[model samples]
Target: MLSGGSTGVGLTARDELESTISLARTADKRGFHRFWMSEHHGMGAASVSSPPLMIARLIAETTRVRLGAGGMMLPNHSPLLIAEQFGMLEALAPGRIDLGLGRAPGTDGATAAALRRGADANDGFPQQVLELLGFLDDDFPSGHPYRQVHAVPGPWQAAENRVSTPTGTPQTWMLGSSPYSAQLAGQLGRPYAFALQFGDADVDTAMRLYRENFQPSDALAKPHTLVSVSVAISEDPAEARRQAGTSAMAMLRMFKREGYLLLPPDEVQAYQPTMQERHILDAYTDRSFHGTPETVADRLEDLHARTGADEVMLVVGGHCASLDREGISLIADHYAMPRSEIPLPVAAQ
Candidate 1:
């Protein structure tokens, strides 16, 4: 599971991210495979504008968990810059980095326009992805425009990346909520991750297409996949609903162009929702998996079996770090994930 550090309506921004790191320390010990953050800009609700910076901070704070972006909107910056930033992360924590790519701006139209000025990222995503790989691999073809260019920390690239070596590159995946990206990932022979958190996209069809069209390559001899979902689980069903409600309200606020932050379930309960709004909320809640750990795990297992997903990433619903951390512990326990025996640092205490 990953949190972009959803800063609640009244909470301080620092707490949102710092607390995720706090949870990451727990995730490190709990044997979670990876810790990733989302990239959003010009939003008061989310403080994770620079995922690379956060990933670096996470590397310094914990050991063992692979850190990277849930995605970085590639069109917003130079490909070489992304390569160098991740190259540095690979340098800091050799085999512990992932680079998930998303075409979405991760922001509103005005903000995205401001970020791109005029370039259309959606149109250039494929080319940009290839360019990024070339730089990261230092394999631009003969006489190519950027043939001579090399990403810094250039010595540590895919060619030299191995568990036997201290330096390694990130595990790259194309992230999407649609089949287009799924097909593209297959065509490129890269790993694919589909987001089922939104509730609207048909992840099953997308994943099926990815697997069907997959072309084996050096990076992956077969299709490697992961699916992301929105979930909230608790022994008490009502409590589970309340936790999931916070996320529903947060999303409602986002859609309405209102304030963008998680709201306590109490507030949501007290506020009067229109009939249509209530219906939407009800539908969304029904779509999410929630209950006891056993119940939730069973549902997740079914999803895993149905989608044939090699890995499952979660976006836990909550209003604070404690709720998210508790969610992590439950899921980790069910999966029998690894745990660290070391005690918390004095400062953390």
Candidate 2:
């Protein structure tokens, strides 16, 4: 997943947002199967508040790469709206759109409250997911409140127009950092994405739960798991650690509720951390995959072997766009991912 997030060390919001496009193009050219943007609200460091809008822009710039929200926080918006947005995206990209839904707020408590408008939306995530599926498929049960309200540009839209979209609706995946989400995804028979970068959740346990509880669905015959991890790769191991430290510092600040902006490695080195802060920072850095491409690749391979994840999504951490892109290229080269001969299309200015 090429996240729409930046460290915000020395870059403007516009620079970071535009850099996401460049990164997406690189991911596409290098044959990364999916390029997913994340949704984060009221965060200075994360400029992407709307994944669908970014996906739309990416669709125009890249060819062959699957574009998706790595994910959209479901509690913040109406399920029908999400259905319509992703439904339209599926229409545009055919088999290339994924809708990864998460129950978390993806923001602080105050920001989440503002987004939810005093409603307790998180608890209804499962129901909302079902409603969203119903809207996308137009298959609500009789007497259901939303049975008559169809999501335009959805499967119903194609049927109404007699348009043949053999590619089908947007592929939905469940995203979470806990067992609850793992079980939910399994019960629904949806692909599950465990975000190991954000929290200290046990990937082994989560994957076990997902597969053990798995039920077959139309989209997937068996359990499909994607593990997303934070990674920073460079020719120099020390340089990779430095880049990784920038993100670790940013995460530390967010944990302390101080700020979300990422500082440069120099700044991170200059500041003296408290003993407790050092422990927290170390824990964050320890779980991340950082070092030379060979080292990171070995770690990623080990993780995949342990968890049996169908896909491993790298949350590449770096202080600059060039570094991030370079890290991506290095990892792709290490894995021997196929590259496209066609040049990436430049986004409209």
Candidate 3:
């Protein structure tokens, strides 16, 4: 996943976005199937404050690699606007777009209110999601009132507004760090991507619920899951730690108080980690794939098998710029897929 540099990390916002785009282009050249960017706000570290626009811009600049929000926090914006924005992106990138929706307030309450303006603060997110579906689906009759409200980047009311690819349009996925999102994905018959970065260890339970309760629908003939893994790789684990400092620290500040993710590796190498920091980081340790190519492969295999995930979406943190090229190459090689044909797979209907 592409992140707006970590909040307490050293890199500036501009650098984060530019570097993320550059790395994505390289990943396309490396044959990775999906490229997901994160969305956040009120956090000083990450500049990817807005996900939909970022995806739209990134899609315009790259050819392969399905682009989407690791997730768009649905509670932050209007369902109509979200549909319209993604509708336009889908049109531009065609089958390459993936809209992974999340129900959390991406930011704290104040920031959330500012984004939604005078809209209902407590508006039902589930109800909003249903409305969003109606906007994206073209089968809606012309007489529908929402059809008259045009989503600027794309037409929201018509099926024809879909993103066209050599084969078809973009697909949608549901993202969650908890069981709620997993169950919702199952009910909707959509693919699910879990967020393990927040140190959430209940992924197994969530995944199980998703698969077991999944109801077959026209969008999906069977169940599928994507597990998000935190990956940091370098020839030397020590060097990797240095690059991950700011991000590690950001996690520390937000979740703890003492350490930082952007600190020089040698410095943190000597200092002792507190029990709380250790606990928090340990929770995120599930798919902790770090080190060289050999190490990465082993971790990847283990994570895949443990999660029973059909795909493993990665979240690269800290000073990830320097590691992007090599990291993407290493991952693509481990997957055994050639550096071509990285389009989103056609979902079974």
TM-score of each: 0.93, 0.96, 0.82
Relative to the true structure, how large is the alpha-carbon lDDT of every model? 0.82, 0.86, 0.68
Which one wins by TM-score: 2 or 3?
2
Ranking by TM-score: 2, 1, 3
Model 3 TM-score, all chains together: 0.82
Index of the highest-lDDT prediction = 2
lDDT per residue as tens, model 1, 1-349: 4544667777787888878787788778888887888889877768889999889888877778788798989998899999999988988888899999999999888899999887566898999999999887777899999997878765544334543453457888899989899999999999998888886899888998999989998678999999888878676778888888888887777778885668878998887989988987787777777777888899889999999999888776477667778877887788787667756545455
lDDT of 3 at 96: 84
**Between candidates 1 and 2, the TM-score winner:** 2
Output the TM-score of candidate 1.
Answer: 0.93
Full ranking by lDDT: 2, 1, 3
Tens-digit lDDT track for model 3 on 179-269? 8878889998988888776664599999999998899977788998888766777777766555555355556656553333355445544
Q: Give one clash count per candidate, in the order shown.
A: 0, 0, 11
RMSD for all candidates, in order, please.
Answer: 2.7, 1.5, 5.5
Report the alpha-carbon TM-score of model 2 versus the true structure.
0.96
Q: Please, what's the RMSD in Å of model 1?
A: 2.7
